[model samples]
Target: MSESVIPRPSGAQQGRRFSLGPALLFCPGSRPDRFSKAAERSDAVIVDLEDAVVPGEKEQARQNVVQALNWEEPGLDPATTLVRVNTASSGELDADLDALAGTELGHLVVPKCESVEELDALAERLPGVGIIPQIETPRGVLEAERLAHHEAVVALFWGTEDLIAGLGGVTARRPNGTPRGVIGHIRHTVLLTAAACGIPAIDTICGALADSQRLAVESEDAAAEGFIAKACVHPNQVATVRRAYTPEDADVEWAKALIAAFEQEAGLAMDEGRHAEPTVVGAFSFRDEMIDAPVVLQAQRVLSRYDATRQR
Candidate 1:
């Protein structure tokens, strides 16, 4: 993507909170058994409708997803099962919404979300489904704030390929191997928009399914840039995505110390090595803004999970 093509927000603002698991399992309808098994191990399961199902077999994929939702899989929370529907204007949109309407599934992942109006229409149809809108075009990125704030919208995921193509971005690889120009700008815009709206920000699917090393790097890169979770094209990418989202030991320790420090003095003294200035802790540095929320919570979340696991 090119810098000129990707539009930036007019003013400086805070970022958003992203909720991602170690891995989100994706089933595109090609491999049912693989998809089912992946769902068992994945942090969340996403049944895909776009880019996965053949044109002629789209209905079959929809039926498959609905059937899967009706199945009672042990240990699988229906709330964590997300259906990735086709674009709001696609032929399959109504069918997708109909299938999702009465189900126990809590999330609907809608692609090519170009405006809040589209969301309004979908929300009218579904009434109460949590919308995870995929911003995959220039118009979509520009309207991100509105989409993010839409009552139906709970999260926004960036789609690199579609947005890049929309912006006429070159496919050529940079010297470091990452795409240069327009494509990178689209990503930056997606991050900025999601941050401004205070919703979860997710990264697009990594195109390189065979290169595990590259996949790991890409996942980590998204994490560093404030993307909480990433879309997976294959089960192989789930573990990599999960590990990328997890906090390291150092992070967990820091979060624990911060929480402990604040609890001890009601926000007075942090650990000697960690706190250069006692006053910083007194101000409650960690809780002031959205940009810092993810880092702080990630650490806290890790420790909590560890504690919970140990008890069981």
Candidate 2:
């Protein structure tokens, strides 16, 4: 199949706002038959036009994405469906953009994103689409903060294998599956950069498809480190990722009790003529632990996540 010659949409909106759920699954773009199934099994589905498809099949894959994501009656929800396009330097992005020209798909995962200029070009070609820049190389890591601050960037994601290979390392993790020092630093760098930019950060995939235990542990660690979601290569990993991100019953109860206690304390202080903001005024003891501003915020976040999980 030849690349589609669709005309690029004009006057594309910039800096589109979008949200993603806790677990995202990547399905090869060439596999149109699995598109609906993947979307059903995951919080979001990424139709990959990059690494997953071979060179000869790229055109066919693009055609599949175009057909599957048709605007009038898309096989997948454009809001939650993401297409992973080829890197800016790969010379395939133009065809990828051409294929996606008129589709209602609103999100694209730009692999190996390393600079603001690259993002600027994408914005010019496909304005308003939420771009998730995948940081996997040394330059990408160094430029992460700048990339996160770009007006077109909606989220940041970090990859481990590519980064390790770029650095000429043998492995990104230790024997126990924990990230090595370098990989750990990069992970935190991406997380902190995204947090600073007020955007969500997605953790990389766990390639060991058969090891659900390891996937669970890694997903938990990613959630604890403040990642909004984890990317998975297989459908079976979706439940594990979602469970890891969801707040436990004990945690939900603690958050509720803490908020109630704080509200009561605030109400009493108001009656006594003391200023009570919905936040910590000073150091206070709750459940034998010192509850301060940060602790209160943590509790609030837990409740917020709990509520979101319930809604989903």
Candidate 3:
């Protein structure tokens, strides 16, 4: 399978290798038959060993996952091929790590993480691979900043389903179906914590897989909320997530125009031979919006991603 690059969110560095890509498709550890097809649809493929398998099938599923990971992948970037292992505290984790030891698995989706010690242990065990800890429990949500900054963690994932289940309650939803109240609060906390720690935040899976419109709305909402990517249980969810995350053609054009205006303004300032303080006039504007540090970075990222996609 050939690789498809999903650009990281606005403000991320260009060509960063370990980006948390938009929309990862999950393949059950027991269902290797779906692995190839799932990879074809999503930005990345996650062969799941945790929630997807029961105790009786766990050992076989682990072996199947290992085989699939080691198999030839012509189109999938090694970094894009991930595995979601059993939790750190699960006794199965040691075996899972050992099973994946010699392969070129680039990332892992860690579930139900609530402690920095778990991340520390994972760091010691899996030396080089990227780890995206799934913050599901209240404890995990509260300790998100620590999890985000863990030496081994590449990104933080806010798992909505697990979170609600952990809380033993329901997350109220607005009439529009977006998460509301406590659910929204926890999501924002995870997002803000990741931002504070300078890591990407991946939004949890949208359960309404059959409803493309809802998925789009939710994906857009997640991106607006500062998540770099989202998890998808089914392959069909990939396109909607990609569309939501990809900078729109108009937005990309606007970003380019904004950057051009800034550059032109800087040139005019220098040509006018007017030396002013760094804070003079505050900044430049594209249309009515002020082009501040974040805006400028976002414009650059938009253009960068657009250009990369075009080149590919």
lDDT, model 2? 0.84
lDDT of 1 by residue, 190-302 (tens): 77777676765777777777778878988899876777678787777877877776667786776676556444544435443232323342334544533233344555555
Q: What is the C-alpha lDDT of each candidate?
A: 0.67, 0.84, 0.74
lDDT of 3 by residue, 68-158 (tens): 7676432334667888899755678899988888677888778888888887777677767778888888889888877776767777787
TM-score of candidate 3 on Cα atoms, chains taken together: 0.84
Off by over 4 Å in 1: 1-20, 72-76, 170-176, 267-281, 284-312
Off by over 4 Å in 2: 1-18, 71-74, 265-285
lDDT at 189, model 3: 88
Summarize candidate 2's per-residue lDDT along 150-235 as a digit string, tens digits. 87788889899999999999999899777899998999999999888878889999998888999999999988888988999999
Better structure of 2 and 3 per TM-score: 2
Q: By summed lDDT, which 10 consecutive residues of candidate 2 come out lowest?
A: 8-17
Compute each candidate's TM-score over C-alphas. 0.78, 0.86, 0.84
Q: Which is the better candidate, 1 or 2, if ranked by TM-score? A: 2
**Per TM-score, what order, best first?**
2, 3, 1
Q: Candidate 1 — which pairs collide?
A: 1-181, 1-182, 1-183, 2-181, 2-182, 15-195, 16-195, 22-242
Tell me how far the alpha carbon of residue 66 in candidate 2 is from the true structure, in angstroms, after superposition: 1.9
